[model samples]
Target: MKENLKRLFEYRELLFNLTRKEVKVKYKNSFLGFIWSLVTPLMMLVVFYVAFGVIFKLRAMDMKYYAFYLMAGILPWNFLSQTLTQGVASVVMNSDLVKKVYFPREVLPLSYLGSASFHFLLQEAMLIVFLLAFRVPLTPWIFMLPVLMLLEAVFIAGLTLLLSTLNVFFRDVQHFTEILLMAWFWMTPIVYPISQIRDNLPAWAAKLYMLNPMTHIVLMWQRITYNSPVNGPASYSMSPAGVIGTVACSLGLLIVGYVTFTRLEGRFAEFI
Candidate 1:
């Protein structure tokens, strides 16, 4: 395990090239180019806002009950969701290269994540712009963003490792992933705020939501942005304990995914 980790560091160039390739391919032959990333999320936000915010008039008590609420949650969710969907096909997409060359198989998945997250970063910048446009106050607590982002990277990479490897064997994994992702989006506290659910809700019910993990990530985001000037009193900011848990969970999933991938990778070339 230590050797594999060391090897990853040793071949950092390979990582860079692969990440660059993914990013280039992402915008390849596109008319609007990278604008697609920004457009997609923004368009979705408008649709959702009109449906849930206007028609239904959901009173999002904690999250300002507005478009910004969905923006914060959706931007991160879009990154995580899109990366996994596209990354599941990473190994197969490079099937020719995989057969001919020998590189850290894990690096392939990591590259997809790195490239996708680049777009995610752009979306985040736009999110910041929205916050500013609305006069949301900024605070030192916003510095916590990088830490949360790293946590997000860790979690997404882990999931990709597991999904991409399995995807090679079972083409149906792609279909299954689609269904799972749809369910996951709903499970996450993206479309709505967690606080609106009432503090006195049954413990089991809360557990059901928390089990999603993205729940914690979303709440942390709301806390960070809301603390500024957007939606004050939206949350209790992540404490040391919360930070530890986020990192631990991210690392734990990453390790598990690596083990599963290495174990299953031997079969990828054959089964795939």
Candidate 2:
């Protein structure tokens, strides 16, 4: 593992170049180019705002600056979705390079993660701009944004490395990942507040829901970015235990995923 880390460090430039290429190639022929990143989130915000905020009256439940709240969760969710969707196929998509190259195989998925993270940062910047435009007062919790982003990135990196490696052997893993993410999105407290789960579900069921790592991550995003005093208290659903468990789980997953990826990497060329 130490040698693998050293090797990956040696190929850091390759990772950066691949990440840059992934970002550029995504919008190569598009007229709007990077604007689409901002647009996509904006569209989701509008639709969700209308549906939940307007129609369902979630905003009426003391959730001021509800649009900001929605964006806070949606941006991170989109980041995870895009990373997994592309990362799962990263190895197979680059079969030619995989067969010809001798560099770290982990770079492929990490590059996709890098690209998604780049777009996620842009979307977060746009969200901050919207917040300022609307005269919403920023809180000290906003300073925690970088720490939160790093935590979320670690969680994503572990999952991407594990899934992308397995996907080379089983093509169905890629398709199932899409379906799983669709369900996983709803399972996490993204479109709705976590209060609904606690209030509606039985105690055992709610405890089960809290087991998902993204639940804590998304709630942390809301706690920082959507810190409306009214809705804010409810967002603090995670306890100290939950936060500690999440951090431990993320680090452990990264180790397990990297080990799995390295052990299985030898068979990747044969399967591909």
Candidate 3:
């Protein structure tokens, strides 16, 4: 593992270059280019706000700046979704390079993650701009954005490495990931508040829901970006135990994923 870490470090430049390529290639021929990144979350915000905030009346429940709340969760969720969707197929998509190259195989998924992270940051900035435009108060907790992003990234990188490695062997893993993410999105408290789960579900069921790692991560995003005092105590759902568990889960997954990726990477060429 130490040797793998040293070797991956040695190829850091390669990772950066590949990440750059992924970002550029993403919008290579598009007329809107990077604007689409901002546009996508904006569109989601509008649709969800109309559906939940307007139609469902979630905002009537004292959820101030509900659009901001939606964006807070949606942006990070999109980051994870895009990373998995693209990263799963990354190794197979670059079979020629994989067969010819001697560099770290992990770079492929990490590069896609880098590209998604770029868009995630841009969307988050756009969200902040919207907040300022609407005269919403900013809090000291907003400074913790980078820390939250890093935690989410660690969780994503682990999943990407593990899934991408397996994807090379089983093409179905890529397709399965898409379906899984679709279900996973609704399972996390993105479109709705976490309070709904606690209030609506039985205690045991709510406890099971909290077991989702993304649940804590998304709630933390909502807590940092959306949970103003005016939004009430219900909006503030993150607990110390949840934070500790999330950090432990993220680190554990990264280690397990890295070990799995490295062990199977030797057989990747054969499978691909």
lDDT of 1 by residue, 135-168 (tens): 8765556778887788888899988898898889
Ranking by TM-score: 2, 3, 1
Error of 1 at 247 (Å): 2.9
What are the lDDT figures for the candidates, one per model? 0.78, 0.89, 0.88
Off by over 4 Å in 1: 59-65, 199-201, 227-243
TM-score of every model versus the real structure: 0.90, 0.97, 0.96
User: Tens digits of per-residue lDDT for model 2 on 48-98?
Assistant: 999999999998777877888889899999999999999989999999988
Model 3, span 243-269: residue lDDT tens: 999999999999899999999999888
- Which residue pairs does candidate 1 place in steric collision? 137-229
